[model samples]
Target: MDSPNTLAVRIEPMTVDDLPQVLEIERVAFPSPWSARAYEYELRYNDMAHYFVAWLDAWALRHPANDGVIGWLRRWVRPAPTVGAPLMVGYVGYWLMAGEAHVSTIAVRPEHRGHSYGELLLAHTLQDAARHGAHVATLEVRVSNTAAQQLYLKYGFDKVGMRKAYYSDNDEDALIMTTPPLNSGQYQEKLRRLQIALTMQLNTQMGRKLSLVSRTGA
Candidate 1:
């Protein structure tokens, strides 16, 4: 079961100042975490790279005077620099290429796992992609990540193919997954159900404790 603290977790957008924490989580989560230089390159060169973080927000009430910022998630429409104030908690990184939205990465902090943050992030990403004219979304997952595979399946992504020796660190094959055409009524119904499930899970985790305004104020 998810801890109450995890239920109260928040997502936010990544910022240049968040590199340290972001890299820390990356290092712990992946054997081949992208290097600081690579992240720098993404921030600089990539016309379409987004990054985000997720963290517990219990401190919000304890440190009310401090910034209420918590975790984040990031997604990019282009490789350009992110604009405006950052408000990410867990990010779904994807690329909109040739009319398809390709999810490149999704990660949550270890302490915040199994709380549906990833699903929330993906749902938000899909919505954004649809709004931006993407008709489909694709992603590749490590064969060993059964949990992630199940999550993707719950989101209506299906295994369409695979790539041999796709992961560099272990040379593991990757399972390529794709969603049904986004315009289909069936797909929309599935997405709606998933979104409802996600919201309910989040609310349950939070104990449906308070109004959004009160919670945010805390």
Candidate 2:
């Protein structure tokens, strides 16, 4: 198994082409996975929805052991970008309404759950929301999901309310969480610092071998 240290993280807009992998992840990550039709609707028709996938291209990180002249050339010459599919380890989705960004879903493959990748996804979502002029962010999580609640709290979200029997599948109550104004200088500065810390964490974990690319254009 490749270490989390070997991960090359890339976040891009989710596409129909990515559905198979994303569906697999969705199944493994959640007990009640979203249907393919629903994902298709979001990707193809929803205008206010923004979705992203976290890709781990370990091949690049695993192939840096060559030496000598060929190695020198390889080091200096960037590999031609290949049109290959990526390994989808996680995904997130949110809906932008008025000036609020509402997180609809977030998940990571079971094998990839413990390495702070969820936080990375949430961070990117918040950052994207801020970029799009969103004043605040919100989400609803299962009342029993303490791990997720902790992550939200760490990112400045607070428990605002609850929806009784919000989950149709099990009639579970949902805890609503909301963050303070994201456009404020204090919040932005906090995000900036967290982004820097994530960069350093990834660098230290990979021994400086990987780059974290989280682009919002998609």
Candidate 3:
């Protein structure tokens, strides 16, 4: 059985009120965090934007005095219902343009990186995109980000192309990837397999942590 602490994390949509918290996390997570004004614009001006936060009960479960966001994602929606809430433990963001879904960004807090939260967020985002009638999903990742590339490939996304100097930080090129057509049985099956693998991985990590805590207490 999972411990109460492991089950307490929640994935919720980003609201106007969440910007302060989101920006804080962004500052800690990204060297070039988006400005507060940028976040404000996203919340107020962009009708197609959907943001989310991942809330992890880090302190309450162990330390008792520390709590903070564990992950976040900002997605763009095109004429679809916005999903927002309990502040997610990770987030997936994308844009819909010209009948294709273009993933903008997906980030997990450093502490939460190995726990499958990214996978959860991606799954949720992909499901939502399908629900919103996207036929194809696309995204670009830094060439150096092999971990992210593997994750995308696991979901049936293929290396379709590349862009020169796509990321500004180090002028890193980006590898453009695209998923098979949405609602296709092959892609859905791959997604299902990936989800299952992610679930197992998360559960294993949670179990290990819980066991270590129990042993140390004993």
Among these predicted structures, which one has the highest lDDT? 2
By summed lDDT, the worst window of 10 consecutive residues in model 3 runs over: 209-218
Each model's lDDT comes to 0.65, 0.82, 0.64
Displacement of the residue 67 alpha carbon in candidate 2, Å = 23
Arrange candidates by TM-score, descending.
2, 3, 1
Query: Per-residue lDDT of 87-183 in model 3, one digit per residue for the tens?
Result: 3345555666666878887877554467677777777778667766789889998899899999898888999999999877788999999988988
CA lDDT, candidate 2, residue 189: 92
Worst lDDT run of 10 residues, candidate 1, spans 209-218
Residue-wise lDDT of candidate 2 within 110-206, one digit each (tens)? 7456667788899999999999989999999999999999989988999999999998889999999999999999999988898788777766654
lDDT of 1 by residue, 1-218 (tens): 23223334444555566777677667778888888787777766675654445544443222222223332211121121233222233445667788898998787766446767677777767766666677999999999999999988888899999999999999999999999887678888888887777777666664543221111100
TM-score of 1: 0.73
Arrange candidates, best lDDT first.
2, 1, 3
TM-score of 3: 0.75
User: Which is the leading candidate under TM-score?
Assistant: 2
What local lDDT score does residue 154 receive in model 3, on the 0 to 100 scale? Answer: 80
Q: In the order shown, what is each candidate's alpha-carbon RMSD?
A: 9.8, 7.9, 10.9
